[model samples]
Target: MFSPFDSILAFKTAIYFFLRSLLKGFLRRATGLCELQRLCYANNIGAKRTKGVEKSILLSRCPVLKRINTQLDALAEADELANNWSTVEEAVEATMVAKQINKSIHEAFIQPYRICLVQIYGYRQLIVRLDQIRGIAFDHNNEVHLVLLKNLWKLLCPDTELEGMISKQWTDIGFQGQDPSTDFRGMGLLSLENLVFFATVYTDHARNILSHSLHPIHGYPFAAVGINITHMALSLIKAGYLKTHLYNVESRIYTVEDFHKIYSYLFASFDKLWIRSKPNSVMEFSHIRDKFEAAVVKKLQFEDAVFRWDPYLETI
Candidate 1:
């Protein structure tokens, strides 16, 4: 049961919302604030009375702003007879002001401490591309549910920097809010281990969308490797640890050291990550990891040299 205060606040919220809608739609009216105050009073929401417990009874009798305007036409016309006249401008101003106030009231009723959800999605591409591969492909719009994943990616990575990296990479792939289970409640979202998952799971459409999501600009065939290495690097950075790795291109492995010198001025930020898959991301990482497990593995070790030696890596 809501208190009278709650009812008034809800009414205020609705009125203000209507105002915002009117503004967006460029709609106008011929009403004013006192009329709104009257509407509240008539709905048993104002200074005089209180004691409505039935939602159906209480809400059914309440007048909507639109209806109120229609009902007040005769009274407003009478007012025009008494005064000079009026236009829709007064009504619009009243509604808009009410809307802003209602927004404030609504905000006041909300709980503090806004929360952020970190959602992670599994392999869709690897699943689609390899029709033979077996794995889960989340197809539902709201399939993934995440309250918090990995402490908002806290560690060596600055909160903001980690946030940027997460947003740039995984955040966009995430599908949140869907309950994954058939049960009454609970979201269906889950994560697959990077490259392996990508190579073995994901629907064809999921695969395409996942690829596009990762590299909306340039489709890095090796994006998976880059993602894994980046996550590994960020993890290490958070733990005050480090790693060394390589960058891959077209099945060729080049030491980060080589590119460090060539793109030293540019790829310096990734100095800690080793840029080796030498593919780019999880998909690339999956392939490179299998083909070159003998060579790559966890060789991408990091140390103080990762940042002290290369400034850009520190930003990542």
Candidate 2:
């Protein structure tokens, strides 16, 4: 067993194994490079070349990286999963998933990056669109935005006497100065829209929270914090971090409602967070906001994360 011939053979076998391993790894890297090239060329000749099962797999998975591929496979079955066109909430809908199978396989199955590219484009466009709206300089002459602002004020201050847009009554809801317009400089009409949507759609919850904002000892500026939260959500979406919450939905599924839902989640959750933090005064808002954002980020890291608002107090 200890013969020179046996020892020489063992050494040779070990060397051969190491060389084969290196060769295999090199081949794998080469194959991955080719795949990346195909992905880059996905809209062109690569689309025509990829066919049948391979094509389907590539469409569903996109093969961007090994890790993502593995994660997608484990998270969902390809056939059961909805195509990118379906909304995130709709994708998980059983009826929609069934209908998806009826659509042409060719159309239903396309590279996810195409969807991502569209959403990224749309996101930039939305930013520009909102920015333009913001640039409109809060015309007191305009009936639409001003009317909406008045409606929001009226809804919150039903019993109070009306004093128009310049009233100190505006401060009760958290506007920075006499004019609510000044506070909306950063978010424009978008902030106002979010506030109106929150108050109108969730009237009871909004009223309850407004009362909380008037808490004798501990309170933050309700409308001001709402706008800041909108900025926080926009930052998350722009950075592509919202992808976690929208994972089950299609990549192209950005909407104003989506943003509003985030606002609601932030509003409701921040209330709970604020109460729990038990700050001695409103001056601690920055610290609490940072902590709240950190918590939201933690939740977004989960694969199954969904933005939700669970209002603890009943509508007043």
Candidate 3:
């Protein structure tokens, strides 16, 4: 399947990497610092610095360093929780030993490298936590799940009393049918968690957005669109597209709460965009959703990107 041009290009790429590695080695000996340390010193604190360190670590030939990265990823995949700080400390010490980095001379690299590790592994842990929550299907038989479902209703519609466990009132808040459980199929409890967090934490904003969703002409299914936004957030996180925003904003460990914040922001932003565009009906949701996602992805391509919900900006 390989054409002559393709073979030539592959050979050229290989030679380029080989020469680049040799150059890095020569520079390391001359500067008396590893690639990571040099990068840490060159770049300021934030996404650029952290991303540089991450790249250096991933490209490292050191077995211990590679194993540490593998182990962190494996921990997330297995849904095994561990103390992030302790893990970072062990990884830093192990990486130093593997690279023969002198602690006395390279003490400056410690904090920055540690921060990068925290962000790196913290992201993995966040993915694990999200997957664990998303895996739990909403159960009507479960008391806790029922309580959460009721709580969401109470937060959104305080004056309205539920007619029953399953009723048309559910449709008032955007459920497709009398039974709201079916709407949570793909996203599972993660969707519910995101919705509840937005309503509970940002009551006024959530209400305003809900009001927008009820627009007679442009009305859309509130809960359904929220679940769709949750899916988008999860996709962005898993695809590593959120790293620029996360790295710039969170110096510490990332959590499920952080993810909820992201989802809420997306939901609110989507509401604003929806109103501005003034679609004839809810039928345009798929196109608008894709447009919104593309915009978010574009914003996240910048190293300085940090998304936060501002109450003042929510006025529409």
lDDT by residue for model 3 over 1-316, one digit each (tens)?
Answer: 9999999999998897798799899998999888888888888778888888788778777788889889777766665535445666888898888778999988998998888887887787898889989999999999988988998899999988888879999999999999999999999999999999999998888888888889899989999999999999999999998888889988887889999989988999899899889999999999999999999999998888888767667542
What is each predicted model's overall lDDT from 0 to 1? 0.29, 0.62, 0.87
Q: Which candidate has the highest TM-score of all?
A: 3
Show where candidate 1 strays beyond 4 Å. Answer: 1-147, 150-213, 217-285, 291-316
Q: Which residue pairs overlap in candidate 3's backbone?
A: none
lDDT of 2 by residue, 164-203 (tens): 7798878889877788898888877878888888888877
Model 2 misplaced regions, further than 4 Å: 1-108, 111-125, 250-253, 310-316
**TM-score of every prediction relative to native:** 0.18, 0.63, 0.93
Sort by TM-score, best first: what order?
3, 2, 1
RMSD of 3: 2.1
Candidate 2, position 138, lDDT: 66
Leading candidate by lDDT: 3
Rank candidates by lDDT, best first: 3, 2, 1
